[model samples]
Target: MNNLLIGLVRALRHHHWLRLLGGAFMLSSVGNGLTQVVVFGQLLRWHASPSALTLAYVLATLPGFFGSFFGEKGCRRVPPLRLLILTELLGMFALILPLLGMFYHNIPAMLAVQSVAAFLAGMSYPALTLTFKQGLSAEELPAATCMETLIFSAQVLLGTGLGVLLFEVFSPLTLLSIDAVSFVAAILLLAATARHIHLRPLQEMDTPPQVAVIRWAGLSILQKRSLLLLPALAAVGSPAMALLPAIAQQIRPGDATGLALPLLFARSLGQLCGPLLLNGERLRHYAKSNRHLLMCLGIFLAAYGALPLLAAEKTTALGLIFVAHLASNVVFALGTFSVLAYFPAQSVSGASAKAWRWQTLTAALATTLAAGLAAQWGATQSLYAVSLTSLAAVALILVRYRQ
Candidate 1:
């Protein structure tokens, strides 16, 4: 932990813009955990119908469908620093409206405000992703990426703990009011520091006739690879999550959630620890070791297939699930890092944005497929089928890992 703090301090000291950007996001992430639970709790308090809640969620995510295109355009047209500051300002307004709506007990108004904020938040992810890729020197990037994954996990952990504290100790309204203040503070900090970040990189798609054409044509070969390959492999891992409640059924019968939450907590631990495996040395080792990484990723997916057989000892099954999640995260992180590292500096942001779009699309498709398979085969056999998909992914990777 000391090392992580020291490493982040070094990264910030070396790169001036990163400190402000990272600080702003750290505040946002911290605030989001509390805000999410509070808003959800408030909607339940208002006796929001299931359909109304679902529509709110659907509306919130609508921006993500077009987020990459807008983010890439913003990168092309506006300086990333200015774009980031603008997004922060928009986010502050989004938060303030919701806070006010809570006082009026207006569920619809809160949902509207949240949807607008979600759209900006969605776009900001790619913006920051590009900023990190562009701003950090090559030497700083490896350490920074590892540190980034760890810090993000820590943010989730710490923020969740604080949210639980607030849920127990304070009113939901109080929690949201604090969330609004955090956003305001983030905006002020961004406004103060972001102006000094002057970047004038040549915009790759500036000559394009339309936004869609520009986004499509600007994708690099690596971006194409990430879009085509990674998401399918990710989907191949979906059965593990899909069958969790089912697995809980096998172990605890009627108390499915009783065991399911522990399984999730175990997986979360894997997420927390996974990125640590990709140190600077390991990354350098695998820079040309794409084939090796592909194999390991295949192996993790294959293990998920074996998950069904482990049900005799549910405790042991949880342990394997933990390892599988860890391996998946490590391989995925390294594969993505390779994509970011290998691409041209000018095109890295576009590639990263495209990857986000691919994941978003593939995740929806994969979830749909996983649900269909689960419905057909039940829990145990469905995982066997899921494992077969991983095997298929492995077959595909073996052919293309050369790239």
Candidate 2:
């Protein structure tokens, strides 16, 4: 434990600014976590039409669909540190706008602002991803990714907890205020660390034809075969996330907060353990590493497939759901690490961002479709649909692993 802590400290010391920037980036997520859960729960309580909630998801997730195009440019023109700082500032304003709406009794207006803020925040992820990518040595990539994952996990757990606690004591707006302060703190930390970092700009290369960063050209991103799996995976897995609120709903009225909080905590726990389980050394030494990844995917699929059954049979299965969700996220994170390892250094940031963009696009598209279906068929049915899709994906992964 002492040695592990020491290593983490050394890792952070290598690039103090990255540590600061990462912390800032993560802190902002706390606000986002609080804001999203509260809004989603309230929308459900209001009996908001599925279309309304779906529209919100679409608006927020839509920005990420084109993030790859912007990410490429952002990677080329902007330093990662500067990019991270700028996005956090944008996120700060976005968080504040909604707080104002909540105070003024403008729920729709708040949703609108929240949607746009989510879009910008989603777009910002790639730039931040690149920044973290650049901070690690080649040998440290897996551990670095694990550390990154752990940071995000920590954010989700703490953010969800804090958000729930504040919501109980105060209101969603109060949570939003606290979230906004976190963004400010993140920006300050990044600014303080800016002087210590020197990031390399992208090397000059032949430019691809200019494409709209925000414009969705029909089938433009879809043409990339490798990128296709990204969206497929996201689409198949995301509906289970919809189960989060339902699980919370089952616990108590307005108790969705408590249930969802633990899921996030469980996910973070898995993230923390996953790195320890699959360090760079293990990843490098494992024979048939692709098969290993496949095994993890299988674990995720099996766990996810059992969730509905568990929820139906066991009234107090939150603990089971937590373990299952944690397993799923760990597998997902491992898949992400594999994808990152496949990228060339020069392409890492651009590729990482674009991949995530594709994932979000597919997931959003899936959610929009599922939201409509859930309105009619029920959320439980929609979950089964997602599980079937994930099982098929797992099969494909296994087959491909064999090849």
Candidate 3:
């Protein structure tokens, strides 16, 4: 524990601004959690339809569709830190709109405002994703991935803890105010550090045209079939995430909001521990020598696929299954992060940030489909569907691995 703490302090000092950027990312996540706990929970008091919640998710995420396509190119032109600060500013309105809607008792107006905020956020993701990826050098990649893992874990655990505590004492508007302040502070931090670091730009590559870039990405996916297969499978497994809220809704009517923070906390715990276990020199050497990252992925997916079956029992079984499910989820998070970090730096392109666009596009489609499927079959059926999807993806990966 002392060693880990010392490593973390050293990491922050070594990459101070990037570390700040990671903190900024966590702050943004906290703002997201605030909205989830306060605004979304408040909105649920009105018995908002699952469709409405799903629509909100879509609206917030829609920017990724276009951003994935164009964001990489834009990042090439702009400084990453500047782009991140601009993104933080856009998120500020998302914090404010809910407060205004609450004062007016205007549900539709609030949703509309939130939707716009979500879109702006979506637009920002590609740029921010690239900037975060570029923040680390090749040697620091593992620790970088670990730090990222830590930040997200902290965001989930601390954000939820903070949201629950603050919401208990204050109004939703008050929480929104806090969120807005965080974004402003994040922006201020970036602005202060903006000019200090000289970042490498994609133009330094004298890269091929856009069309050729797409072809190259496509070929990379085809050639590195094991690498591509895991993310693709992971994408299809997204329905498992959607099922959480739906199941929580069933656990106690309208308690879906209550489930978000706790589930996020559990996920965070796993993510934080995962990097610690995976980031050692031995594993890195093993991953590089054998280059069989897919084997670990297969084991993880098998456990993920089994979670639903384990959860299907009644009473005593349900509790056991739930524990199993949560444990599997943590392992999944660790496995996925580890696999993603193994991709060669040379595969990264100016138009995309180290597989970010591809992963986002794949996840977007999977989420859309999973949301629809969940709506139709309810949460349990969706889990079964996810389990089956994972099996199929796992099968494909195994075949590709053999080749």
Best by TM-score: 2
Write model 2 residue lDDT over 59-99, tens digit each, in one string: 65666667455655776787766776777777777766566
What candidate 1 gets wrong by more than 4 Å, as runs, is 1-9, 35-63, 86-122, 147-155, 164-178, 196-200, 203-223, 226-233, 238-268, 281-322, 374-384, 387-391
lDDT of each: 0.59, 0.59, 0.53
lDDT of 3: 0.53
lDDT tens digits by residue: candidate 3, 225-253:
42343255346444454445455555557
User: Per-residue alpha-carbon lDDT of model 1 for 302-326, expressed as tens digits?
Assistant: 5555665665565776687677767
- Tell me how many residue pairs clash in candidate 1: 0
lDDT of 2: 0.59
Judge candidate 3 at residue 389 and give its lDDT: 71
TM-score of every candidate: 0.71, 0.80, 0.75
Model 2 residue runs over 4 Å out of place are: 1-9, 49-60, 104-107, 200-232, 247-273, 284-291, 301-305, 308-316, 397-403
Looking at model 1, which ten-residue stretch has the lowest summed lDDT?
205-214
What are the root-mean-square deviations of the candidates from the true structure over C-alphas? 5.9, 5.1, 5.1
